[model samples]
Target: MTEPVKLYVYDLSNGMARQMSRQLTGRQIDGIWHTSVVVFGRETFYGQGISTTLPGRSHHGAPLQVIDLGETAIDEETFNEYVMEMKDHYTADKYHLLEFNCNSFTNDVIGFLTGGSIPDYIKDLPTDFLSTPFGAALRPTIDAMYRRPSPSEPTPPIPSPIPAANATPDSQLAASILQAVAAHTQASNSTPNAATQTLYAPIHAITNPPSFHSFLKSHRAAVAFFTAANCGPCRMIEPVFERLSEEKGVKADGTGAGFAKIDIGVGLGNSLASEWGIRATPTFIFFLDGKKLDEMKGADANELRSQVDLLLFQAYPPHPHTSLSLPAVQALSLNPILFTQVPAIDTVLTRLSSFIDSNPWLSTTQSPGQAKQTLTGTVAPYLKARFSAAPSSKLPSATPTLLTSWSQATSAIASALPVASLFPLVDLWRLALLDPSVGTWVSSFPTSSPILLFIDKATAALKIPDPTSNPRNYLLTVLRLLSNTFATPALARSLFLTTRAALAEVVIPSLLHTDGAVRTAAASLAFNVAAFLQKGRVDKVKGGGGHAARDNTLEDEDWEVEMVSAVVEALGRETTSEEVVHRLAASLAFLLRLSPAYDTQLSPLLDVLQTRAVLKRKLTKGGCGEDGVVKKDVRKLVEEVANKLCP
Candidate 1:
């Protein structure tokens, strides 16, 4: 009936031809007739049963002609001539040329004979041909051949060379593909109408239910309620959920597309809950067309009402008349107490002094709220106004009068300094520090009894020998203030010269005081001053020249060397009291370790240590011998200093 389709297959290598043949046979083909060209002369043809792998059988039905150009072999011109002669003699459509390693020359022949159109029987090769391992090796040549233009026209200029197989696709191309897929998916889905809907579809329920496909078809938009029966908050929100559905005219019986609950009880699985990323009980999800729109969790009543109103507006836009403008409140009414004027300077100072005297705790403690109430509320407002309005020109002239009054008030407060009064005094000090005029008054105060004495006592309390009694927190605050003073060079230098001289005159001589805390505080203060000097904040005393000779030498360095020598000398004299010797040794060792420049300074100290034979001899006199506490403590401190400084 119909002649079997003569499939014109060409340029297929041995492996690809076999694969194509197998695929064709699987389609239940009847017979295959093969033709091969030996030359352009005597003809040969093959039957279906004959072997085509052999040389003679290869061209069984084709012509035998001896056409050889050279070892370099058939160029395009020669090939085209051979093809033209064959087409003139035989039906070109019935014969196909199976050439090996064909290039643009092969395409030229095909195009010339077929009018530049590929024959119906000549199917394109599989796309994976150049991707295979063996094909990959020859892919460049193969691609060149496929891309070659017809011989009639100059080979279309070779476009920019493609990158190698290892190269990845451009990022924009990948993103474009993804965006196209997303757009296609969105276009295929139905849009949800929020107007007539009661509740939004449950995101988790719809995504997880067995009948999810049917549910999505029936209800376009619904609300998903994620809750656990055991959660107290979830139980509390049940009434709110019910009311929201009723307001929207939704059936409470869960018949229509309304409120749907996903119970995450102990026995029930929560795979769906996790899929929707629900972290807490009473989480609500709004959905449209099987996609999540918005979510809310653990909302209070007012917050829930606002959310409901927002959702309703989105579902049903309001009429023009119903949308009324409301003016916003910008300022709150002020309380008369807060509005009261600042008190007179003298009265404020007097109240501060009186509060401090009545409550000893005011000297250190601070509570801004309590201080504000006491000063601004209890103190007469009229007197405060008078002092605030006083001319700046009169302030200097009035200083002595103000100071005398302050001194009298402070003495009165100090006489009855109770624990409750400390906070008020601290507030007064803060206010004084803030006000330039008051700060000047404090700086010039003649009596050191109240300010400096209180500082010394407080520092002593902080350094108590018993850990339980030590005011560690208060000491930390004092240290912070000391650090602040040293933050600026001018302040640090002034403080160093003043405090250093003070320590040398008053603090150092009192080391053997009755209280352990007093001795410790003195030592600690000395150590801090030394540390500050070591940091290069203070200038040394000068001679005839304006510049000091010891300007470049660090204060801590000189202090450490001097103190170490003093301790060694004290230990050697054997005349100094045991307590003094002990204290000196302890303080020297502590300074040696704490000083950053210990290694640079240690050699001189060690030399002194070696020259003093009495100290070394005393070390051997003890029962514990060389490893006793005194020798051990000194040796350990020296060893640590050596490691850190040497390293």
Candidate 2:
């Protein structure tokens, strides 16, 4: 699950700066901007050193504006872990209004959550204020107020929020912060002063014996470098060691080899060196399963590399699947496809206005008339402002009221309008669902929802004359909208279970769509379904003790068989677009890749359906578009899938 991330913008000077900015600074300036990040049920800001409070309950009182920064897949436990690490750099005495204030802290947190930074208005407020002549004169005074003390003495950061039961105790949390701050101070004092430069080394620095022991116990295999400041050979070989760390030491799945270093001249580094019985200035030790396996005294780069590789081999044996030649299928991205293109806001609003003006029943009835008024008055301006803004600009919050109104208005308006005329409304709602607030609300709807109603009506209309005929604009737009709904993870998960049959009804027939655009949209939706299911398996495998375990990923075996059968049939019929054929093949790979019952359930089903023959014929038939060049990439992928199926 993901939490919606919001930026709470508070005016530090309240209304005073806005009122008296011209008189004080000889220029117009907005209120002094203070921003905090609100996520996972906590509002975190930096003032008295990274404080946290319930949202909107800070001493700063209410926020002037709340901007929707989007959602993050980070859970609360992981987010708090980040906060604990942040306590070191954001101490109470480190606070400076102009240099590193509330906005600085929020920008970092926001970047971590959404991979996006805070707005320019909030971030650049300090520079804008200091640029004024009157403000420039007081810069020195402000600097004097927040002067840095000696490097020896450092203030401990404020304690983190007291977590609930089964969490880290308050005393334990405070002790950890103090220990970290003390270690940082000791390391700073011990190291010879040097110019700072950015380095791409990911090696963990061991300062104390306890942490060193913990690090060794946690990783299956680890390498520790022991060195001192005065050792010339240590300095010379450090760069090579850093390069190795960058290349093979860090991984997202936590299976990468561990690399660490200890400086014998700083803090308890000497204690570790003595405990490990290392008398040399530059020494290397390789460990496997938390026991010392191999030891080398000198920093021979070639020997170090070979020993590290040997340690990894001993720790983690290679899986047989690693021998498979399936580069084309392996290279396929598992990210879901989302249609985020913004249509003209004025055009959409104008069409909505005309629809409302022409329909007599819409204005004559009570609920429908109120719904029409809500659409025109509330939703029209909302879309205009949101869709018209730049992509990076902060958007107005989609409140619960607006979402509720939109749901009722769209459903009520659909009842009054013809199925063909509902495309514009679906398109508008599609854009609205991109907002996390709106998406979460709509996804919580059980089986009956206005969005689902529109989809059912649209698909029901598609079978008007013949099933094989090309889909109408209404159904095409509805398919695109359905594909976009997977942008919200919750909605995608629910669609697989409660509304599984409804989704299969719309997706199966659409996969064989006559129009390439309709077929492409249907393919995108199928890819999303497969990706979501594949993710569950990938996560399970990662969490289930070993990376090489084969896990049963089928959440619903019946639905999986149904979707795979449709895709296989679609592949046989697909001759026009090689890109669509590649998507179908990729979806098939995701569905069958990690299934425990692949041999019994999927492979036999594929064999009976003649999947290998269908794929080989595609290779023979060649490509679509532009003189039939036989898209080599598509053929490679299809051939690979066929091999996997039959092998």
Q: Per-model C-alpha lDDT, please?
A: 0.37, 0.70
Model 1, span 378-404: residue lDDT tens: 332423433356534443222445544
Give each model's clash number.
22, 0
Error of 1 at 260 (Å): 99
Per-residue alpha-carbon lDDT of model 2 for 509-598, expressed as tens digits? Answer: 889878888888888888888887877765654443133344443377788889989999998888788778888988988887765556
Model 1 residue 286 CA deviation (Å) reads 86
Worst 10 residues of 2 by lDDT: 192-201
**Model 2, stretches more than 4 Å misplaced?**
1-325, 352-368, 389-392, 445-449, 462-471, 545-554, 621-629
- Reference-based TM-score of each model: 0.23, 0.50
TM-score computed on alpha carbons, candidate 2: 0.50
Overall local distance difference test of candidate 1: 0.37
